[model samples]
Target: MKLRKINKQVWLTEVELDGYNVRGAVICGDKKVVVLDTLSHPRDMETLSTLIQGRALIIVYTHADWDHIWGTGGLIWEDARIIAHTACLERFNTDVPVTLHEKQLVEPARWNGVQLVPPNETFQDEFCLDLGSLTLRFYHLPGHTQDSIVVFLEQYGILFMGDTVETPFPCLEKQSPLFRWITRLQRWESDPGVKTVIPAHGDMGGRKIIQRNIAYLQDLSAGKDPGVFEPMTQFYRETHGANLGFALNASKSDAFKLDASKKNNP
Candidate 1:
């Protein structure tokens, strides 16, 4: 419903994806176009692709998260090369047994009939795509997920951090190296060129979002009160209807009260 042009090459559109308001980006280059993430359902991307007909569009998945990459089969562009972190491809191949069952329950009606597609191309640390005048830098940031990565447009200073620090609910249960994740975020926070931050889940902001996420995790690491952690879980569940404690050994709490027991390992 809302659209914001970040730069000459970047356009942010807040679209209704699978009944949830999710953000997607279109990064324009002289010779090609780059799409940040996909929608929750196939029809959503089908609709998005129609709007972007007759353009050189390449799709990149920031991570292998269901919300961002589940609709890959919808956007049918022969020229659009799908790219993601190497680990993400592995994650995509091996579906978590529990999440497979959970996804069956919450996935949108449109996604019910579509076949899923995994990324064809994968990389480890760094990959550069030169779209004539614009250059995209994909860096591996293993925090939210060991497969999690951020897309940095060096020419524009835009960093598309996929689920790294968008929502209050942290999805580190699937993450392999937690400490490295923390370190990656801290280093990004101090990067002077990273002026714009685009998250796969929430509103796009500046470097402040990175700092806020770091603070929340640091508190959690220190064993802070459960009261402070309640909001994050509730916010994610309320928005996505996802159970935050799916695979993790964490407690669940209701948002109705600020009780002492309303905390979980978000």
Candidate 2:
């Protein structure tokens, strides 16, 4: 795992967790510690928990995706609190069977031979978790999923976006209200407090990446072809080509590109 301090109390950990490069956040408060997302595999979560040793762990699921929440079972203690957006609970109970089955077939060993577990606590619209000195704000940003939430460490100026805007145009067929997703992306882009965006699948970066995402989504909505994925994919491949084999060979990516072509040529 690679660690970087983004702000005073916020820390980013880039872990080669399972089959994905998962990023988790640690917010150290006056009395305790808060974790943003867990890893993808039980082994990774065990490693993370062991590393955090004495600190109190508060795990918040940014969304209901398997990569983000599958390791929750490993991270939770007897007394730890697990929270997520209200919609996420619904997703966990209803739609996640398909997601889990897909993941199970693709990588059977990681699912732990169990079903998806709904989060214990859920909130709507916005919720503020008072971590003594810092407030971790959870915003229900539903484009990624109806239950998708973005964690904003207000004092730290870091937005832990779970598949919200990693690329110029993130595929949104899985989102509930596509237009609303676009709206939230624009709002985040304009917010100066959102100094650093730590995405679930990419490197932590600045607001300019948000702008690039907006442009790509806009291009998609305007019936303009984005060819095979967005321009950012090419940049990502060139910049981190050696480490980005997943992006280059993603099955859904070609489908996304085909969807763009159909929309543009329609």
Candidate 3:
């Protein structure tokens, strides 16, 4: 893991997972130190202690995807609060452990010290944490995954996009609400307060990143390709193919038009 202090109160950490890069952020507020996603392993988070000092700790999971939530053991103790969307918490009872077990079975040493830590506090659509000078507001964006969300630093004009938005294109899953996802991205793109968009797997940019994702999802929803993409890594190239398959199936679902009006699964 490589950590770079973004400012006096914010830090960015990046880790290589397989061939793709995953990112995590730390925001230090007057009252607490909040960590967003823990990256791929425990050692990836080992340096958090020095950055956190003795401040109260809070861990927020952008979603329960294994790569994003697996490193809690390195920085969390009994008192730390783990926060996420309610749907993310539910994943712990189902796919979360199953994924961990499967990876451990494949290579025990690599995933050995990782623990499955579920969020102790969860919300439905939106949640906010007041960090003195900054407020970390989380909203359910629900594109990459039902529990996926984006974080907004209201005071800093920065948005932390988990996997809801990516570099070349956004990946699609079987039950993704393409309509709702595009709608939400459109909303964010229009927000003047969202000056910087930082995604977990891509270069950080301004509103253009959000705009690009919106365009990709829009094309997918219309049953059209989202135009040619710049050359991406082998992982993303493979992901684009899978995204097309999922989008084809999603477009056939009755739920496509039923999106953006209500919470995806609720």
Candidate 4:
């Protein structure tokens, strides 16, 4: 794990686990230390605990994906409140075990100490945490997953977009509403307070990253191939294809419903 300071109060920790480069953030506020998505393993979070010692701790899970939440078990602060979207709690309870089982099969030793920990506090739509020096705002952005959220540090204008936006291309949930994702992107674009955007799996950038994701989603909706805009890694190529497939399938489903409606009305 490598820790890089984003600012005096904020830090980014990068970890390579199971072939994926995942990042989590730490925001040291006046009254509380906020730990963003925990990395893949319990051992990864041990150093994090040491760094934020002696302050009130709040663990925020951006989503319930195994990579982000697995380290919840490893946190040293037992009394810390775990926060997430209500949908994230549902996903953690229903889908996380299957994901854990599949990943453990690949590397049992690394996951040996992992314990499933669900959020103790849950909310829908939006929530805010006043950390004395800065406020952390959680916005539910559901395109990546039903429970995916983006964290905005109001004072610093930094946004931690958990897999909601990515470099090259953004992945889509099978049932994600493209329009809703586009609307969120548009809102971000117009928000003058946003200075930086941090994605879970890609390099951090400014508002341009939000524009790029919006363009990709718009292209997918328009039936225009988005591969021409950027070169994708093998993994991202597969991801883009799957996203495109989901969009096409959704379009067809909508068309079919329209046709059925017309026939019934006539």
Q: Which candidate is the best by lDDT?
A: 3
Per-residue lDDT of 1-266 in model 2, one digit per residue for the tens?
A: 56667666776766774334778777788766777776565544565654456777777888887777766666655577778988787886676778788777987876645435567788988988988888888888765566778888877688888878775345453312434556787788899989888788765689888787667556555545444444455544443332133233322355445544544232
Q: Measured by TM-score, how close is model 4 to the native structure?
A: 0.92
lDDT of 3 by residue, 37-99 (tens): 999898999988988889999999999999899999888557999999999999999999999
**If scored against the real structure, what TM-score would every candidate get?**
0.77, 0.77, 0.96, 0.92
- Candidate 3's C-alpha runs over 4 A off are 260-266
Q: Which stretches of candidate 1 lie over 4 Å from their true place?
A: 1-3, 16-20, 96-109, 174-176, 226-233, 237-266
The predicted structure with the larger TM-score, 1 or 3, is 3
- lDDT on C-alpha atoms for all candidate structures: 0.66, 0.67, 0.88, 0.83
Give the count of colliding residue pairs in each prediction.
0, 1, 0, 0
Candidate 4 local lDDT, residue 171: 82
Better of 1 and 4 by lDDT: 4
Candidate 2 matches the true fold with a TM-score of 0.77
lDDT of 4 by residue, 226-265 (tens): 7644555677767877888888786677743453344323
Pairs in steric clash, model 4: none
Cα misplacement distance, residue 114 of candidate 2 (Å): 6.2
Location of the lowest summed lDDT over 10 successive residues in candidate 3: 257-266
- Residue-wise C-alpha lDDT for candidate 1, range 149-265, written one tens digit per residue: 888886777888887776554455522333455567888899999988888776678888888777755544444522333444444555323222321222232221222232231
